[model samples]
Target: MTTTLAKDPAQAAARHAAPGQKRVTRRPNWVAGTASWIWLAIVIVPIYWIVITSFKAQSDYYAENPLAPPSNPTLANYQLVIESDFVRYFMNSVIVTVGAVVPAVAVSFMAAYAIVRSGRGRFLRYTNSMFLMGLAIPHQATIIPIYLIIIKLGLYDTPMALILPSIAFSIPLSVLVLSNFIRDVPKELFESMRLDGASELGTLWNLALPLTRPAVVTVTIYNALTIWNGFLLPLILTQSPEQRTLPLALWTFQGQYSVNVPAVLASVVLTTLPILVIYVVGRRQLLAGLTAGFGK
Candidate 1:
C-alpha cells in the first residue's frame, strides 16, 4: 500500500507517526533524568560505604571518614568472618534455599497450569481464592501454628523445618503469577497439541512450560531471594547452631563482632554475594516478568 504525508511538516509528522510513514524526534525529559540520577546516588552511596568499610581495619573505621575508601585495605576482616563457622551457615542456607525453591517452583507451575487450563467451576474459583488468601495473610500470624507443627513432626532444629514452610509460603504468589503467564498461551496451540494425541500433561510439558519460562525463572529468583534472606523462620523454627542460615548467622555475627565494625561489614558482604549473583544472573528474565506484569 502507498501512503502519503500531509503538506505541513508538523502535520505530516503527526499524521504519519501513527502509520510509521515518518519518524519523530523529541527532547529528553531532563527532570526525569535528574531524578533518576539522584535516586541512583541515594542507593549507591550506602552500597559504596558497605563495600569500602568491609576492607577497612577496625581502628581505621573509627578514624576515617565513613564515605572514604580505605588507604590500606585489608582482608583480615574477611578471613575472620570465614573463620567463625561462616562456611557451615552458608551450606545450611544453600540446603534450605535449594530444598525449598525446587519443590515450590515445580508444584507452583503444575498448579498454575491446571488453574489456567481448567474451565471455570465452583471448585476452581474456590481453589484460586484459597491461594489468593495466602497472599493476604501475614507471615507473622502463622508462626505459632508452624512452630507447633514443626515440634509435632520432630523436624525441629533441622533444615527441613525451614524448607517446608518456605515452600508453603512460596506457592500462593508463584501460582498466581504462573497461572497468568500460562493463560497467555494461545488456545489454538493447545488444540493442535490435543489433535496430535498429546495428553494434558504432555501438552503442559511441551507447550506451556517453554512459553512461560521467563515467568518461571522470575519466580524462582524471587523465591530464592526470599528464602535466602529469611530470618524469622530460621530464628523461630530451628535452634541448633548447625541449622543457622545466613541471616540468622549474620545476627549472631553482629552480636559477637559488634565492637568490630569492619568485621561485621565483611560478614555482611560475604552473606550478600550469593543473593547478588543469583539476581544478576536472572535479571533479564526478572525484568521481562516485571514488564509483562505491569504492562497495559
Candidate 2:
C-alpha cells in the first residue's frame, strides 16, 4: 500500500523534488529579488527626481523640501521648450543617431561575418586585434584631426559632421560584439545549408541572420543610445542652432545670469524620454543578444 501511494503522480513529483532536486531554490530567488530591486532603484530614482523637478516652479526648485513632490505642478517649462527650437534640436538628434547607427551596424555585421568565417590567418588575427586596438585609442586626441578633415571636406556645421564620426567610432565595437555572436552560430548549420546547395549569402541571410536577430537588435539599441547621447563630436563639429542636438540645447539653459532650472530640467526630461522608451522596448532583446554567445 505504501509503495503504491508513493508511486502516485503527486507523491512521485514531491519525491523527485525533494530538497536536492527542488524546482525552486530560496537562495537564487532571494539573490535575484535583491539584485532586481537594487537595479530598479538605481534606474528609477534618478528619473523620478528629474520628472518631479521638471514639474516644480523655479522658486520651488530651491525650496527646503525640494525632493518632496510639488505642491502645484505646471507645464510652463514644456511651454518654453516648445516655443524654443527644442523640437528642431530633437529632430537633429534623431537624424544624426539614425544616420550613424544604421550604416555602422550594417557595415559591422558584414565585417564580423567576414572575420569569423573567412579563415585562420595572421592577417585575420591582426585585423581582429586592430578592432580591439580602436577601443584603446582616445577620441579626444583625434578630435582635432577629425575636425580638420571635416572642415577640409566642408562638412562642418552640418549633421554629417556628427554622423560620420559617430559611425566611424561605433564600427569597431559593433564588429567585436558581432563577431563573437556570429561565431556562436552552430557551424553545422552553415555546412548543412551549403550541402543543400545554398550560396554563402543565402546561408547568411536565411540561416545565420535569423538566429542572430537578438544580437543585431541589441547592437542597434546600444549604438542608438551612444549616438543619441553623444556630446563632444556634435559640440565641436556643429556651430549652428539649427544643427544642435538635445544635449547641446540643454546648455542654453545656463546663461551668464538667471538660469532657468525648470526649463533645463524639462529639456532633459524630453531628451531622456525617448531613450528610456527605446531601452524599455529593446531590453529583453538586448539581454538575450548579450548572452547569445554563452552556452546555456
Candidate 3:
C-alpha cells in the first residue's frame, strides 16, 4: 500500500499534507445546529422552571417572577412532600414499575424469540398479526372493558390490577421490537448451537440473550418509563390511597379550592428522578438497540 501510494506523486502529496494545512473540510450545519438549540430550549426551559419553582415558598411563588431564581430557596416544600406520605407513594410507584416491566419484558423477549425461531405456521402467523394489530389499540379505548374485567376478577383497587393490565399492554410493542432484533440474528449461529447439543432454551439463554442484550435493555427501559409514569391505569383500577402510584399520589398537593404549587412541583421532581437516572444509565444501549431495529 505504501509503495503504491509513493508511486503516485498526487496520492503521496495528499497522504501527507503540509504542516498547518487542512486536508479535509466540513461545512457547519447551521440549519441543524439552530434547530437543535431551539429544541434544547423547548425541553430544558420547562425542566428549569420545575426545578426552580419546587424550591420556592408558596407565597413567593405567587408574588415573585415565576421564571426568576427564588430569592430564598428553601427545603420546606420538599419537607412537606416527604411528610405527606411521599415515601409510600414513591415505593408504590417503584413496585408497580418493576413488577410490570420485568415480567412484560421477559415474556415479550421469549415470545419474540419464538416468533422468529419457531417455524412459520398459520398459528404463529396469526399470532404475529394479532400482536401487530395490538399496536393500533389505544389504552383509552380498552379502559372500560379493562375496568369491568378488573372488577370481575376482584383485583380492583390493588397494585395487581395495575400490574396485570400494564403487562398485557406492554407485550405487543415489546414483542414487535424484540422480534425484529432476534430476526436479525444469523440463522447459522442457531444451527451451530443446535449442532453442539444445546437445547432451544440453552441456545436462547447463551446465544440469543447475549447477542440481543441491547434490544432487551431498550425494551426494558421503554416499558419501565411507560409504567412508571402511567396515570390512567392507577386512576381507574385502584381507588384506594395506599395503592396510588406516583402520578396519582401527586393529588396530595391538590386542595378542593386551592393547590400547593411548590409542593406539587417538589413531588414531581422526586417522582421523575428515578426514571431519569435509569434512562441516563442505559441510554447508550437503548440507542444502539433502537438503531439496530431501525436498520433492520
lDDT of 2 by residue, 15-105 (tens): 7675766475445688889999999999988888888888988887887375689888989988888778878989999999999999999
Better of 1 and 2 by TM-score: 1
Cα lDDT tens digits, model 3, 27-78, are 9999999999999999999999999999999999999998999999999989
The digit string of per-residue lDDT tens for model 1 on 1-296 reads 99976598877668667664656578999999999999999999999999999999999999999999998999999999999999999999999999999999999999888888887867877888999999999999999999999999999999889999999999999999999999888899999999999999998889999899899999999999999999999999988888899999999999988999999999999999998999899999888887885755
Instruction: For model 3, state the Cα shift of residue 197 in Å.
Output: 0.3
Work out the TM-score per prediction: 0.90, 0.84, 0.88
List of clashing residue pairs for candidate 2: none
Candidate 1 regions with alpha-carbon error over 4 angstroms: 1-28, 293-296
**lDDT value for candidate 1?**
0.93
Residue 118 C-alpha lDDT in model 2:
86
Q: Name the 10 consecutive residues with the lowest summed lDDT in model 3.
A: 251-260
